[model samples]
Target: MDTTEADESIKYTVLDNLLVDGKEPGSWGTFITRSEMYTQAAQMNGLISYLAIYIGFVLVVACAAILSIQQLSNVADGSRSYRVLAQIGCDDRQIRHSVMAQQAVFFLFPLAVGLAHSFVALKVIIELVSIFGNMSIGGTVSLTCAIFLAACGGYFLVTYLMSTGMVRAAIAIRYSE
Candidate 1:
């Protein structure tokens, strides 16, 4: 028969060298057991690691956004480079775009490297786990990617907000003069 019927029949059938009577239903009745417990324990560790990495990613993004905001603020506050740029007749829009572009570049560099490293490192780790003759090359990787993309999206949003504030501050300072 099909797998479903064969599997069910095997579960219910007595062994030729019978130990326990197979007439009894499986103990714990579909409930989790010791194996399930260890499996869940391993999964929990992965979840915890994921969460720690997630927190680190958020902190990294926050720091990058803050650094970008501070640099933009310094430029807009008539710093040396600001004076030099104004002498060249670079308008306010140019200044704003320059600030945003710099932020984008800075944010993108570490991000791209981190993403590549995450995928490669995890792939290696999975392979290593299998090579040691213990755990198989199983579990999930796409879950980590999803977490990473969410963090990146949050970073981008924060970058946008910081840029908007800096540009407004620059415009106000420009008008005041």
Candidate 2:
């Protein structure tokens, strides 16, 4: 076997001593816990937690990918708009604000809608699974909302930087030509 920096061969123990590492599947990030030397189907609602987290990650990434592509297109068109606005009455700050506003709408609309869907879906999941196991609907709901909002905030930040750069470029072109 070609040994790399790390490797662990799976063994046929109860795996209760295992970290839910991807070594185990359906896990990511740094998580470590010792099981009760036994195994269960994760109490249904607990399963729901994992399901929600994974789906949230996937949905966020997919939406970000789409947003990235759409933002590229908008940047191109915004350049023209910014240049023309400059030729008219718009100043640098106004053009920058317009760039920000455009990207804001482009990002915020889908972002809010996606979070709404995630909220409702995760809430339903928690409610549905609570019948089988103890679950904190309120806590998870709030946490999910915060995380979703933060994700959107992060994307917004990135978009802001990119849009600002575009504005600078457009402004520079106007001055040069």
Candidate 3:
């Protein structure tokens, strides 16, 4: 038989098998063409990719917020120390620089550790996936890293600004009193 005839025969054969015993075969099984299967797989992959991106966003935001709040609270508790530094001839620039340094440590340490762990995990994932097929994730990794770093940098800048403001306010209160 020609290819067209063979293809029609296979289609009919699948339909016939599915309708066996005339019981509707609803609970027995179902038929799926190769293309249909591939389509479903692609849809699932898209869903999973979206979910991962969403979860990553939530995690990055949560980490940044938590660190920001923690650092702000520390500044609040240490307001008197800042006031003393200002009284002891430290300039505003110096005080702000101090706050910036502290904020950098608080923000970057956890990020560094997380990145290290992620690298190890990704190495393992690459090894496993390589067994199935050759894969190149360089562009995806670079894009994700760039986005993540931008978010972190934004959060860091905001936190530093807020901390400096709090420090200045504390010093002002000291001087006014």
- Name the top lDDT candidate: 3
Better model by TM-score: candidate 1 vs candidate 3? 3
lDDT of 3 at 142: 62
- Write the number of the candidate with greater TM-score, choosing between 1 and 2: 2
How many clashes in each structure? 0, 0, 0
Q: Pick the candidate with the highest TM-score.
A: 3
**lDDT tens per residue, model 2, 15-131:** 435666336533433322324121244565468667977797778867876786688668777687777888898877887777678778888888778767866877787787576
What lDDT does model 3 reach?
Answer: 0.84
In model 3, residue pairs whose N, Cα or C atoms come closer than 3 Å (at least 3 residues apart or on different chains), thus clashing, are none
lDDT (tens digit, per residue) of candidate 3 on 38-116 = 6797688669767986799789989999999999999999999999999899999999989999999999999999889
lDDT, candidates in the order shown: 0.63, 0.68, 0.84
In model 1, pairs of residues that clash are none
Estimate, for each residue in 15-101, the C-alpha lDDT of model 1 and write its tens digit.
Answer: 322344554345324434444567787898679767976786677667666755655565456444544565578786787677667
Q: Count clashing pairs, candidate 3.
A: 0
Q: Any runs in candidate 1 off by more than 4 Å, and if so which?
A: 1-88, 128-140
Alpha carbon deviation, residue 60, candidate 1 (Å): 4.0
Per-prediction CA RMSD (Å): 7.0, 12.8, 3.4
